[model samples]
Target: MTGVVGPGAVWLVLRATVLVVVAALLQVTVAADLEVLDGRPDLVVIAVASIAILQGPSAGAVAGFAGGFLVDSLGLGVIGSTSLTLVAVAYGVGVFGEGLRRTAAVRPLLAIGAASLAAGAGQLTLALLVGSVPQASPALALAIVPGAMLDVLLAIGLYPAVRLLLRRRGPRTVSLDLGAARV
Candidate 1:
């Protein structure tokens, strides 16, 4: 038990630390716009949500808070907005992912849709609170749908790869036959 717990604890801490650092770096260096469209990929948000889905809601929430706080600290937008958005996104991904996991084909698509919805809704809510809703043609709400769809598409392309890497390297259990191993 001690062996299991100790290693698991270490792995968890290490994983969380790495996730935070990577997310922060991505947020700081990567331009949100992807050139494919006039927008950038929300890699930080997606990372947080993916971690949460893979780890569970609590881990996701923690990752979300850390990632969002970092994003806010960068002065991209009002503080707490990203935090709130990420927490919600993480939770939704964790919950919905359970159901979607049953069908292999649907998991990626579901992740994409859920991730986009969470990010767009969070951003829209922030815009409303900050009173800077984009008001030109189609209105801000209309943009949310398309923006979220784009996010989903991006997630579909990226989530599978991330998932595969995470799963492949995840902690494993090994047994050694000590008595029979004497050479």
Candidate 2:
């Protein structure tokens, strides 16, 4: 398979690296302190999802893993839980994003919402599996709903910025474009 090799690839890597680092840092420092109805927005999820949707699955998965690792390392919880969840969520979102028409508006928002829910559920389930949730309580509702809401809300603003940031200078073969090859 032909791939981006050289300056474009390097620039993409640099941009993605910078984005993941900044998002993770902001997540740990700024977003960690804010609470809305006992829910804290996850900027890392937003970043990963945005990247996944904009760049495609592989990029999304890498961004997810990187951002998740940084957040997990900085915060308190199971070591690989967030990373695992983010990787899966980002990849799925990326795959889903690749199918949509470029002009579609609401679909990206839907993708963000699904990604938020999946990320929240995946992490919460992992926490439960590791016996880290403490006890069966309203923590499930508190953790998923409000946080997902905040995630989608934030994505409304942030996703567009990420989309603009990741505008392709030239097309790279990130995913198959079935529509491009018409008989």
**The best candidate in terms of TM-score:** 2
**Tens-place lDDT digits, model 2, residues 140-182:** 7466878888888888888888877766578655665689784
- Each prediction's whole-model lDDT (CA): 0.65, 0.82
* Residue range 1-183, candidate 1, lDDT tens digits: 111244456666566667666766776676454444544556676677666666667767777878888888874667788888888888777766555553255565667566766687767777766777754344655655655666567667566655653442445677777896843
Q: How good is model 2 by TM-score?
A: 0.84
Q: Give TM per candidate.
A: 0.73, 0.84
TM-score of 1: 0.73
What's the lDDT of the predicted structure labeled candidate 1?
0.65
Off by over 4 Å in 2: 1-6, 171-183
Clashes in each model (backbone N, CA, C under 3 Å)? 3, 0
RMSD of 1: 4.8
lDDT minimum window of 10 residues, candidate 2: 1-10
